[model samples]
Target: MNGNVTAPLSWVFTLVFVGFYVVAYQHSIHLWRWPYPRYILVALSFGMVLWLLVKMRFHLPWVTYWIEMADYAFLATLMYGYFKIQDKDRRIKDRLFQSANWDALTHVQNYAAYDRAIGYHFSRSLIRHNNLTMAMFDIDHFKCVNDTYGHLAGDEVLKQVSSTVVDVLKAKDEQIVLYRTGGEEFNVIFPGYTVAQAQPLVQEFFDRVKALRIPYNDVELNVTISVGVSSLHRTDHNPLDFYKRVDSHLYRSKKMGRQQITLE
Candidate 1:
Protein backbone atom coordinates (compact mmCIF):
# COMPACT_ATOMS: atom_id res chain seq x y z
CA MET A 1 0.00 0.00 0.00
CA ASN A 2 2.85 2.46 0.92
CA GLY A 3 4.74 1.66 -2.27
CA ASN A 4 1.56 2.15 -4.36
CA VAL A 5 0.91 5.52 -2.72
CA THR A 6 4.45 6.77 -3.24
CA ALA A 7 5.07 8.17 -6.73
CA PRO A 8 8.25 7.39 -8.76
CA LEU A 9 11.00 10.02 -8.98
CA SER A 10 10.80 10.32 -12.78
CA TRP A 11 6.99 10.68 -12.79
CA VAL A 12 6.97 13.27 -10.00
CA PHE A 13 9.78 15.35 -11.55
CA THR A 14 8.29 15.37 -15.05
CA LEU A 15 4.72 16.17 -13.95
CA VAL A 16 5.70 18.93 -11.50
CA PHE A 17 8.10 20.62 -13.97
CA VAL A 18 5.53 20.63 -16.79
CA GLY A 19 2.78 21.88 -14.48
CA PHE A 20 4.98 24.75 -13.26
CA TYR A 21 5.68 25.85 -16.85
CA VAL A 22 1.96 25.88 -17.77
CA VAL A 23 1.01 27.89 -14.65
CA ALA A 24 3.87 30.33 -15.23
CA TYR A 25 2.79 31.07 -18.81
CA GLN A 26 -0.83 31.58 -17.87
CA HIS A 27 0.23 33.79 -14.97
CA SER A 28 2.29 35.94 -17.31
CA ILE A 29 -0.66 36.54 -19.64
CA HIS A 30 -2.90 37.33 -16.69
CA LEU A 31 -0.74 40.39 -15.92
CA TRP A 32 -2.03 42.29 -18.98
CA ARG A 33 -5.08 43.84 -17.29
CA TRP A 34 -3.96 43.55 -13.70
CA PRO A 35 -3.02 46.75 -11.94
CA TYR A 36 0.07 45.36 -10.21
CA PRO A 37 2.41 42.59 -11.35
CA ARG A 38 4.02 41.96 -7.95
CA TYR A 39 1.04 40.03 -6.64
CA ILE A 40 1.14 37.71 -9.64
CA LEU A 41 4.84 37.22 -9.21
CA VAL A 42 4.44 36.32 -5.56
CA ALA A 43 1.67 33.86 -6.39
CA LEU A 44 3.80 32.29 -9.12
CA SER A 45 6.74 32.05 -6.75
CA PHE A 46 4.57 30.30 -4.15
CA GLY A 47 3.25 27.94 -6.80
CA MET A 48 6.77 27.05 -7.84
CA VAL A 49 7.60 26.43 -4.19
CA LEU A 50 4.66 24.03 -3.96
CA TRP A 51 5.92 22.13 -7.02
CA LEU A 52 9.31 21.94 -5.35
CA LEU A 53 7.67 20.49 -2.26
CA VAL A 54 5.81 17.88 -4.31
CA LYS A 55 9.09 16.83 -5.92
CA MET A 56 10.78 16.78 -2.51
CA ARG A 57 8.03 14.60 -1.06
CA PHE A 58 8.46 12.01 -3.77
CA HIS A 59 12.18 12.18 -4.55
CA LEU A 60 13.87 13.30 -1.30
CA PRO A 61 14.26 10.98 1.69
CA TRP A 62 13.55 13.56 4.48
CA VAL A 63 10.65 15.40 2.67
CA THR A 64 8.13 14.45 5.40
CA TYR A 65 10.02 16.47 8.04
CA TRP A 66 9.59 20.07 6.63
CA ILE A 67 8.05 20.39 3.12
CA GLU A 68 4.36 20.11 4.12
CA MET A 69 4.41 22.84 6.78
CA ALA A 70 6.46 25.20 4.60
CA ASP A 71 4.01 24.79 1.71
CA TYR A 72 1.01 25.81 3.85
CA ALA A 73 2.82 28.85 5.29
CA PHE A 74 3.92 30.03 1.85
CA LEU A 75 0.42 29.65 0.38
CA ALA A 76 -1.15 31.66 3.18
CA THR A 77 1.36 34.49 2.82
CA LEU A 78 0.88 34.65 -0.95
CA MET A 79 -2.92 34.88 -0.61
CA TYR A 80 -2.67 37.62 2.02
CA GLY A 81 -0.25 39.64 -0.06
CA TYR A 82 -2.34 39.30 -3.25
CA PHE A 83 -5.53 40.49 -1.55
CA LYS A 84 -3.75 43.50 -0.07
CA ILE A 85 -2.50 44.57 -3.50
CA GLN A 86 -5.92 43.99 -5.09
CA ASP A 87 -7.63 46.19 -2.51
CA LYS A 88 -5.12 48.96 -3.01
CA ASP A 89 -5.58 48.87 -6.78
CA ARG A 90 -9.34 49.12 -6.41
CA ARG A 91 -9.11 52.24 -4.22
CA ILE A 92 -6.68 53.94 -6.57
CA LYS A 93 -8.86 53.22 -9.59
CA ASP A 94 -11.86 54.78 -7.86
CA ARG A 95 -10.03 57.95 -6.98
CA LEU A 96 -8.62 58.28 -10.51
CA PHE A 97 -12.08 58.10 -12.08
CA GLN A 98 -13.45 60.76 -9.75
CA SER A 99 -10.65 63.16 -10.54
CA ALA A 100 -10.24 62.23 -14.20
CA ASN A 101 -12.96 64.49 -15.63
CA TRP A 102 -11.77 67.59 -13.79
CA ASP A 103 -8.80 69.89 -14.24
CA ALA A 104 -6.21 69.64 -11.51
CA LEU A 105 -5.29 73.31 -11.12
CA THR A 106 -8.70 74.99 -11.46
CA HIS A 107 -10.90 72.22 -10.04
CA VAL A 108 -13.33 72.93 -12.87
CA GLN A 109 -14.75 70.36 -15.22
CA ASN A 110 -12.54 69.79 -18.25
CA TYR A 111 -13.64 70.70 -21.78
CA ALA A 112 -14.92 67.25 -22.72
CA ALA A 113 -16.73 66.87 -19.42
CA TYR A 114 -18.23 70.34 -19.81
CA ASP A 115 -19.64 69.37 -23.21
CA ARG A 116 -21.29 66.26 -21.86
CA ALA A 117 -22.77 68.02 -18.83
CA ILE A 118 -24.07 70.90 -20.98
CA GLY A 119 -25.64 68.54 -23.49
CA TYR A 120 -27.46 66.63 -20.78
CA HIS A 121 -28.68 69.78 -19.04
CA PHE A 122 -29.93 71.29 -22.30
CA SER A 123 -31.94 68.20 -23.13
CA ARG A 124 -33.68 68.26 -19.77
CA SER A 125 -34.24 72.03 -19.71
CA LEU A 126 -35.76 72.12 -23.19
CA ILE A 127 -39.27 71.38 -21.91
CA ARG A 128 -38.99 73.75 -18.94
CA HIS A 129 -37.74 76.69 -21.04
CA ASN A 130 -35.24 77.34 -18.28
CA ASN A 131 -32.77 80.12 -18.96
CA LEU A 132 -29.24 79.19 -20.06
CA THR A 133 -26.27 81.52 -20.35
CA MET A 134 -22.79 81.00 -21.75
CA ALA A 135 -19.87 83.31 -21.23
CA MET A 136 -16.27 83.41 -22.44
CA PHE A 137 -13.46 84.98 -20.43
CA ASP A 138 -9.95 85.80 -21.60
CA ILE A 139 -7.12 87.31 -19.67
CA ASP A 140 -5.97 90.71 -20.92
CA HIS A 141 -2.39 90.87 -22.24
CA PHE A 142 -1.75 87.29 -21.17
CA LYS A 143 1.13 86.96 -23.60
CA CYS A 144 2.87 89.86 -21.88
CA VAL A 145 2.90 87.88 -18.66
CA ASN A 146 4.43 84.90 -20.44
CA ASP A 147 7.04 87.18 -22.03
CA THR A 148 8.00 89.01 -18.84
CA TYR A 149 7.88 85.96 -16.57
CA GLY A 150 8.68 82.41 -17.61
CA HIS A 151 6.02 79.87 -18.52
CA LEU A 152 6.06 78.60 -14.95
CA ALA A 153 5.14 82.04 -13.62
CA GLY A 154 2.50 82.34 -16.33
CA ASP A 155 1.09 79.00 -15.20
CA GLU A 156 0.94 80.26 -11.62
CA VAL A 157 -0.91 83.36 -12.83
CA LEU A 158 -3.40 81.19 -14.66
CA LYS A 159 -3.92 79.09 -11.55
CA GLN A 160 -4.52 82.21 -9.51
CA VAL A 161 -7.02 83.62 -12.02
CA SER A 162 -8.89 80.33 -12.29
CA SER A 163 -9.08 80.03 -8.51
CA THR A 164 -10.44 83.55 -8.24
CA VAL A 165 -13.18 82.90 -10.78
CA VAL A 166 -14.19 79.63 -9.17
CA ASP A 167 -14.48 81.30 -5.77
CA VAL A 168 -16.71 84.17 -7.03
CA LEU A 169 -19.45 81.98 -8.49
CA LYS A 170 -22.64 80.97 -6.62
CA ALA A 171 -23.40 77.26 -6.48
CA LYS A 172 -26.65 77.16 -4.52
CA ASP A 173 -29.57 75.79 -6.51
CA GLU A 174 -28.24 75.52 -10.01
CA GLN A 175 -25.06 73.79 -11.09
CA ILE A 176 -22.44 75.95 -12.81
CA VAL A 177 -20.35 74.58 -15.66
CA LEU A 178 -16.85 75.98 -15.91
CA TYR A 179 -13.95 75.05 -18.19
CA ARG A 180 -10.69 76.27 -19.60
CA THR A 181 -11.55 77.00 -23.22
CA GLY A 182 -7.98 77.68 -24.34
CA GLY A 183 -4.77 79.34 -23.25
CA GLU A 184 -5.70 82.31 -21.06
CA GLU A 185 -9.39 81.73 -21.92
CA PHE A 186 -12.23 80.15 -19.95
CA ASN A 187 -15.90 79.32 -20.62
CA VAL A 188 -18.81 79.26 -18.19
CA ILE A 189 -22.32 77.86 -18.60
CA PHE A 190 -24.91 78.93 -16.04
CA PRO A 191 -28.08 76.90 -16.43
CA GLY A 192 -31.40 78.38 -15.22
CA TYR A 193 -29.88 81.82 -15.55
CA THR A 194 -30.74 84.53 -18.08
CA VAL A 195 -28.45 87.25 -19.38
CA ALA A 196 -29.67 89.69 -16.74
CA GLN A 197 -29.01 87.30 -13.87
CA ALA A 198 -25.65 86.21 -15.22
CA GLN A 199 -24.52 89.80 -15.74
CA PRO A 200 -24.01 90.70 -12.10
CA LEU A 201 -22.24 87.41 -11.39
CA VAL A 202 -19.96 88.02 -14.34
CA GLN A 203 -19.43 91.61 -13.27
CA GLU A 204 -18.64 90.51 -9.75
CA PHE A 205 -16.23 88.00 -11.18
CA PHE A 206 -14.57 90.74 -13.21
CA ASP A 207 -14.31 93.07 -10.22
CA ARG A 208 -12.85 90.32 -8.08
CA VAL A 209 -10.27 89.48 -10.70
CA LYS A 210 -9.38 93.11 -11.27
CA ALA A 211 -8.70 93.47 -7.54
CA LEU A 212 -6.67 90.26 -7.29
CA ARG A 213 -2.91 90.51 -6.62
CA ILE A 214 -1.15 87.26 -7.32
CA PRO A 215 2.20 86.70 -5.67
CA TYR A 216 5.12 85.54 -7.76
CA ASN A 217 8.77 85.52 -6.63
CA ASP A 218 7.96 87.61 -3.55
CA VAL A 219 6.29 90.30 -5.72
CA GLU A 220 2.62 91.06 -6.16
CA LEU A 221 1.51 90.96 -9.84
CA ASN A 222 -1.73 92.69 -10.82
CA VAL A 223 -4.01 90.83 -13.28
CA THR A 224 -7.30 91.46 -15.12
CA ILE A 225 -9.70 89.48 -17.34
CA SER A 226 -12.22 90.45 -20.06
CA VAL A 227 -15.59 88.70 -20.16
CA GLY A 228 -18.31 88.16 -22.82
CA VAL A 229 -21.77 86.88 -21.92
CA SER A 230 -24.56 85.43 -24.12
CA SER A 231 -27.83 83.64 -23.49
CA LEU A 232 -29.19 80.52 -25.23
CA HIS A 233 -32.70 81.32 -26.48
CA ARG A 234 -33.95 79.32 -29.45
CA THR A 235 -34.33 75.57 -29.41
CA ASP A 236 -32.93 75.44 -32.94
CA HIS A 237 -29.86 77.46 -31.95
CA ASN A 238 -26.83 75.20 -31.71
CA PRO A 239 -24.25 75.47 -28.91
CA LEU A 240 -21.72 76.78 -31.47
CA ASP A 241 -23.78 79.93 -32.04
CA PHE A 242 -23.68 80.67 -28.36
CA TYR A 243 -19.93 80.08 -28.33
CA LYS A 244 -19.35 82.31 -31.35
CA ARG A 245 -21.51 85.13 -30.03
CA VAL A 246 -19.76 85.05 -26.68
CA ASP A 247 -16.39 84.89 -28.40
CA SER A 248 -17.27 87.95 -30.45
CA HIS A 249 -18.24 89.79 -27.30
CA LEU A 250 -14.98 88.64 -25.73
CA TYR A 251 -13.10 90.12 -28.67
CA ARG A 252 -15.04 93.32 -28.38
CA SER A 253 -14.24 93.57 -24.69
CA LYS A 254 -10.57 93.08 -25.46
CA LYS A 255 -10.61 95.67 -28.24
CA MET A 256 -12.41 98.25 -26.12
CA GLY A 257 -9.72 97.97 -23.35
CA ARG A 258 -9.65 95.04 -21.01
CA GLN A 259 -11.02 94.56 -17.46
CA GLN A 260 -14.53 95.02 -18.92
CA ILE A 261 -17.61 92.83 -19.51
CA THR A 262 -19.83 92.73 -22.61
CA LEU A 263 -23.17 90.96 -23.00
CA GLU A 264 -25.09 89.99 -26.15
Candidate 2:
Protein backbone atom coordinates (compact mmCIF):
# COMPACT_ATOMS: atom_id res chain seq x y z
CA MET A 1 0.00 0.00 0.00
CA ASN A 2 2.98 2.34 0.59
CA GLY A 3 4.60 1.72 -2.82
CA ASN A 4 5.16 4.87 -4.87
CA VAL A 5 2.88 4.77 -7.94
CA THR A 6 5.07 7.45 -9.59
CA ALA A 7 7.90 4.92 -9.70
CA PRO A 8 8.66 3.29 -13.10
CA LEU A 9 8.10 -0.16 -11.49
CA SER A 10 4.45 0.79 -10.79
CA TRP A 11 3.78 1.38 -14.52
CA VAL A 12 5.26 -2.05 -15.27
CA PHE A 13 3.07 -3.66 -12.61
CA THR A 14 -0.03 -1.97 -14.02
CA LEU A 15 0.69 -3.24 -17.53
CA VAL A 16 1.40 -6.75 -16.21
CA PHE A 17 -1.88 -6.87 -14.26
CA VAL A 18 -3.90 -5.56 -17.21
CA GLY A 19 -2.32 -8.13 -19.49
CA PHE A 20 -3.12 -10.92 -17.04
CA TYR A 21 -6.74 -9.80 -16.82
CA VAL A 22 -6.97 -9.77 -20.63
CA VAL A 23 -5.68 -13.35 -20.91
CA ALA A 24 -7.81 -14.78 -18.11
CA TYR A 25 -10.90 -12.88 -19.13
CA GLN A 26 -10.74 -13.69 -22.81
CA HIS A 27 -9.79 -17.31 -22.26
CA SER A 28 -12.37 -18.02 -19.55
CA ILE A 29 -14.82 -19.76 -21.88
CA HIS A 30 -13.98 -23.08 -20.22
CA LEU A 31 -16.03 -22.18 -17.17
CA TRP A 32 -18.27 -19.16 -17.90
CA ARG A 33 -20.57 -17.52 -20.38
CA TRP A 34 -20.11 -14.02 -21.80
CA PRO A 35 -21.29 -11.67 -19.06
CA TYR A 36 -19.71 -13.70 -16.30
CA PRO A 37 -16.29 -13.57 -17.89
CA ARG A 38 -16.86 -9.95 -18.79
CA TYR A 39 -17.70 -9.17 -15.19
CA ILE A 40 -14.54 -10.78 -13.91
CA LEU A 41 -12.47 -9.09 -16.58
CA VAL A 42 -13.93 -5.72 -15.72
CA ALA A 43 -13.36 -6.16 -12.02
CA LEU A 44 -9.77 -7.23 -12.52
CA SER A 45 -9.11 -4.41 -14.96
CA PHE A 46 -10.53 -1.86 -12.50
CA GLY A 47 -8.58 -3.43 -9.69
CA MET A 48 -5.37 -2.88 -11.63
CA VAL A 49 -6.32 0.73 -12.27
CA LEU A 50 -7.16 1.18 -8.63
CA TRP A 51 -3.81 -0.31 -7.65
CA LEU A 52 -2.08 2.22 -9.90
CA LEU A 53 -4.05 5.11 -8.37
CA VAL A 54 -3.37 4.00 -4.81
CA LYS A 55 0.32 3.45 -5.52
CA MET A 56 0.56 7.01 -6.82
CA ARG A 57 -1.45 8.22 -3.80
CA PHE A 58 -4.09 9.45 -6.30
CA HIS A 59 -1.60 11.71 -8.21
CA LEU A 60 -0.79 10.02 -11.51
CA PRO A 61 2.75 10.44 -12.84
CA TRP A 62 3.26 11.02 -16.59
CA VAL A 63 4.16 7.35 -17.19
CA THR A 64 1.26 6.10 -15.06
CA TYR A 65 -1.10 8.47 -16.92
CA TRP A 66 -0.02 7.14 -20.30
CA ILE A 67 -0.39 3.57 -19.08
CA GLU A 68 -4.00 4.28 -17.99
CA MET A 69 -4.95 3.92 -21.67
CA ALA A 70 -4.57 0.19 -21.17
CA ASP A 71 -7.51 0.31 -18.74
CA TYR A 72 -9.79 1.88 -21.36
CA ALA A 73 -8.60 -0.61 -23.96
CA PHE A 74 -9.24 -3.49 -21.57
CA LEU A 75 -12.80 -2.32 -20.84
CA ALA A 76 -13.62 -1.83 -24.52
CA THR A 77 -12.20 -5.18 -25.57
CA LEU A 78 -14.05 -7.04 -22.81
CA MET A 79 -17.36 -5.38 -23.57
CA TYR A 80 -17.08 -6.06 -27.27
CA GLY A 81 -15.96 -9.64 -26.80
CA TYR A 82 -18.69 -10.29 -24.26
CA PHE A 83 -21.53 -9.21 -26.50
CA LYS A 84 -19.98 -10.93 -29.49
CA ILE A 85 -19.88 -14.21 -27.63
CA GLN A 86 -23.40 -13.72 -26.33
CA ASP A 87 -24.74 -13.03 -29.79
CA LYS A 88 -23.07 -16.16 -31.15
CA ASP A 89 -24.50 -18.20 -28.31
CA ARG A 90 -27.98 -16.80 -28.87
CA ARG A 91 -27.85 -17.61 -32.58
CA ILE A 92 -26.72 -21.15 -31.85
CA LYS A 93 -29.56 -21.65 -29.39
CA ASP A 94 -32.08 -20.37 -31.92
CA ARG A 95 -30.76 -22.76 -34.55
CA LEU A 96 -30.96 -25.67 -32.13
CA PHE A 97 -34.55 -24.87 -31.12
CA GLN A 98 -35.56 -24.51 -34.75
CA SER A 99 -33.97 -27.81 -35.66
CA ALA A 100 -35.80 -29.50 -32.81
CA ASN A 101 -39.17 -27.83 -33.25
CA TRP A 102 -39.47 -27.42 -37.03
CA ASP A 103 -39.90 -30.13 -39.63
CA ALA A 104 -37.10 -30.27 -42.17
CA LEU A 105 -39.31 -30.76 -45.22
CA THR A 106 -42.34 -28.55 -44.47
CA HIS A 107 -40.82 -26.11 -41.94
CA VAL A 108 -43.79 -26.47 -39.57
CA GLN A 109 -43.56 -27.73 -36.04
CA ASN A 110 -42.52 -31.37 -35.78
CA TYR A 111 -44.51 -33.95 -33.87
CA ALA A 112 -42.35 -33.61 -30.74
CA ALA A 113 -42.92 -29.88 -30.54
CA TYR A 114 -46.58 -30.26 -31.48
CA ASP A 115 -47.20 -32.74 -28.67
CA ARG A 116 -45.50 -30.54 -26.14
CA ALA A 117 -47.39 -27.42 -27.18
CA ILE A 118 -50.72 -29.23 -27.46
CA GLY A 119 -50.33 -31.03 -24.16
CA TYR A 120 -49.36 -27.85 -22.35
CA HIS A 121 -52.18 -25.76 -23.78
CA PHE A 122 -54.66 -28.61 -23.46
CA SER A 123 -53.90 -28.94 -19.76
CA ARG A 124 -54.19 -25.20 -19.27
CA SER A 125 -57.41 -25.07 -21.27
CA LEU A 126 -58.90 -27.83 -19.17
CA ILE A 127 -58.04 -25.94 -16.01
CA ARG A 128 -59.22 -22.57 -17.36
CA HIS A 129 -62.33 -23.95 -19.08
CA ASN A 130 -61.15 -22.71 -22.45
CA ASN A 131 -62.02 -24.37 -25.72
CA LEU A 132 -59.54 -26.32 -27.85
CA THR A 133 -59.82 -28.47 -30.98
CA MET A 134 -57.44 -31.00 -32.53
CA ALA A 135 -57.33 -32.20 -36.09
CA MET A 136 -55.51 -34.97 -37.94
CA PHE A 137 -55.00 -34.08 -41.61
CA ASP A 138 -53.95 -36.67 -44.14
CA ILE A 139 -53.12 -36.08 -47.75
CA ASP A 140 -55.50 -38.22 -49.79
CA HIS A 141 -54.10 -40.31 -52.66
CA PHE A 142 -50.63 -39.15 -51.64
CA LYS A 143 -49.16 -42.58 -52.28
CA CYS A 144 -50.61 -42.45 -55.76
CA VAL A 145 -48.83 -39.16 -56.32
CA ASN A 146 -45.56 -40.77 -55.30
CA ASP A 147 -46.28 -43.67 -57.58
CA THR A 148 -47.36 -41.48 -60.48
CA TYR A 149 -45.06 -38.45 -60.28
CA GLY A 150 -42.15 -39.93 -58.33
CA HIS A 151 -41.00 -39.24 -54.76
CA LEU A 152 -39.60 -35.76 -55.48
CA ALA A 153 -42.98 -34.63 -56.72
CA GLY A 154 -44.52 -36.27 -53.70
CA ASP A 155 -42.27 -34.18 -51.46
CA GLU A 156 -43.26 -31.08 -53.39
CA VAL A 157 -46.90 -31.98 -52.90
CA LEU A 158 -46.33 -32.35 -49.19
CA LYS A 159 -44.64 -28.95 -48.99
CA GLN A 160 -47.40 -27.28 -50.99
CA VAL A 161 -50.07 -28.95 -48.89
CA SER A 162 -48.45 -27.63 -45.73
CA SER A 163 -48.18 -24.14 -47.18
CA THR A 164 -51.82 -24.18 -48.23
CA VAL A 165 -52.99 -25.17 -44.77
CA VAL A 166 -50.89 -22.45 -43.17
CA ASP A 167 -52.09 -19.78 -45.58
CA VAL A 168 -55.79 -20.58 -45.09
CA LEU A 169 -55.69 -20.52 -41.28
CA LYS A 170 -53.92 -17.22 -40.84
CA ALA A 171 -55.99 -15.94 -37.92
CA LYS A 172 -53.89 -14.79 -34.98
CA ASP A 173 -56.36 -15.98 -32.34
CA GLU A 174 -56.18 -19.41 -33.88
CA GLN A 175 -53.09 -20.79 -32.21
CA ILE A 176 -52.48 -23.37 -34.90
CA VAL A 177 -49.95 -26.14 -34.30
CA LEU A 178 -49.28 -28.16 -37.43
CA TYR A 179 -46.99 -31.15 -37.71
CA ARG A 180 -45.99 -33.50 -40.49
CA THR A 181 -46.46 -36.61 -38.42
CA GLY A 182 -44.61 -38.97 -40.70
CA GLY A 183 -45.41 -40.12 -44.25
CA GLU A 184 -48.21 -38.04 -45.78
CA GLU A 185 -49.94 -37.53 -42.42
CA PHE A 186 -50.13 -34.19 -40.60
CA ASN A 187 -51.67 -33.10 -37.30
CA VAL A 188 -53.07 -29.74 -36.26
CA ILE A 189 -53.92 -28.31 -32.88
CA PHE A 190 -56.32 -25.38 -32.80
CA PRO A 191 -56.54 -23.72 -29.43
CA GLY A 192 -59.30 -21.31 -28.31
CA TYR A 193 -61.85 -22.88 -30.67
CA THR A 194 -64.49 -25.56 -30.36
CA VAL A 195 -64.95 -28.44 -32.79
CA ALA A 196 -67.89 -26.67 -34.39
CA GLN A 197 -66.05 -23.35 -34.66
CA ALA A 198 -63.15 -25.05 -36.40
CA GLN A 199 -65.31 -27.01 -38.86
CA PRO A 200 -65.68 -24.39 -41.60
CA LEU A 201 -62.10 -23.32 -41.13
CA VAL A 202 -60.89 -26.89 -41.58
CA GLN A 203 -63.13 -27.39 -44.60
CA GLU A 204 -61.93 -24.21 -46.23
CA PHE A 205 -58.35 -25.18 -45.58
CA PHE A 206 -58.91 -28.64 -47.11
CA ASP A 207 -60.65 -27.13 -50.13
CA ARG A 208 -57.77 -24.76 -50.73
CA VAL A 209 -55.34 -27.68 -50.51
CA LYS A 210 -57.36 -29.65 -53.03
CA ALA A 211 -57.28 -26.61 -55.27
CA LEU A 212 -53.48 -26.25 -55.38
CA ARG A 213 -51.80 -26.37 -58.84
CA ILE A 214 -48.26 -27.41 -58.15
CA PRO A 215 -45.88 -27.59 -61.12
CA TYR A 216 -43.45 -30.41 -61.77
CA ASN A 217 -41.57 -31.16 -65.00
CA ASP A 218 -43.94 -29.08 -67.16
CA VAL A 219 -46.98 -30.73 -65.65
CA GLU A 220 -49.38 -29.24 -63.11
CA LEU A 221 -50.28 -31.52 -60.21
CA ASN A 222 -53.42 -31.60 -58.05
CA VAL A 223 -53.93 -32.93 -54.52
CA THR A 224 -56.57 -33.27 -51.81
CA ILE A 225 -56.47 -33.75 -48.04
CA SER A 226 -58.81 -35.39 -45.47
CA VAL A 227 -59.19 -33.86 -42.03
CA GLY A 228 -60.58 -35.22 -38.74
CA VAL A 229 -61.62 -32.83 -35.96
CA SER A 230 -62.23 -33.41 -32.25
CA SER A 231 -62.76 -31.04 -29.37
CA LEU A 232 -61.39 -31.19 -25.82
CA HIS A 233 -63.80 -30.93 -22.89
CA ARG A 234 -63.37 -30.81 -19.16
CA THR A 235 -65.11 -34.10 -18.45
CA ASP A 236 -64.46 -35.89 -21.70
CA HIS A 237 -61.11 -37.74 -21.56
CA ASN A 238 -57.33 -37.54 -21.23
CA PRO A 239 -55.15 -35.84 -23.85
CA LEU A 240 -53.93 -39.08 -25.35
CA ASP A 241 -57.46 -40.41 -25.61
CA PHE A 242 -58.65 -37.21 -27.20
CA TYR A 243 -55.85 -37.48 -29.75
CA LYS A 244 -56.68 -41.12 -30.38
CA ARG A 245 -60.34 -40.29 -31.01
CA VAL A 246 -59.40 -37.74 -33.62
CA ASP A 247 -56.89 -40.15 -35.09
CA SER A 248 -59.62 -42.75 -35.50
CA HIS A 249 -61.80 -40.18 -37.20
CA LEU A 250 -58.88 -39.40 -39.49
CA TYR A 251 -58.57 -43.06 -40.42
CA ARG A 252 -62.30 -43.26 -41.03
CA SER A 253 -62.19 -40.22 -43.29
CA LYS A 254 -59.42 -41.79 -45.28
CA LYS A 255 -61.26 -45.10 -45.43
CA MET A 256 -64.61 -43.62 -46.45
CA GLY A 257 -63.18 -41.38 -49.12
CA ARG A 258 -60.47 -38.85 -49.75
CA GLN A 259 -60.93 -35.10 -49.46
CA GLN A 260 -63.48 -35.15 -46.63
CA ILE A 261 -63.77 -33.80 -43.06
CA THR A 262 -64.85 -36.15 -40.28
CA LEU A 263 -65.66 -34.75 -36.83
CA GLU A 264 -66.22 -36.74 -33.63
Which candidate gets the maximum lDDT versus the true structure? 2
Candidate 1 lDDT, tens digit per residue, 1-264?
A: 134445575466566667767865675457455534644564556555555656465564445535654665577567767877897898899789658677776666677776776676666567678888888998888898889987877888889888877877754333675688677889988888899988888887789888988888977888898898988767436666667888899999989987888888
Query: Residue 80 error for model 2, in Å?
Result: 3.0
RMSD of each: 11.1, 8.7
Best by the TM-score measure: 2
C-alpha local distance difference test of each model: 0.75, 0.80
Record all residue pairs in model 1 with backbone atoms less than 3 Å apart, i.e. clashing: none
Residue pairs in candidate 2 whose N, alpha carbon or C atoms collide under 3 angstroms: 5-55
Candidate 2 lDDT trough over 10 residues, lowest sum? 28-37
Would you estimate the TM-scores of all the predictions?
Answer: 0.64, 0.73
Tens digit of per-residue lDDT, candidate 2, span 94-154 = 9999999899999888888977887898788988999989889888888889999899999
User: Candidate 1 — which residues are off by over 4 angstroms?
Assistant: 1-86, 95-99, 170-174
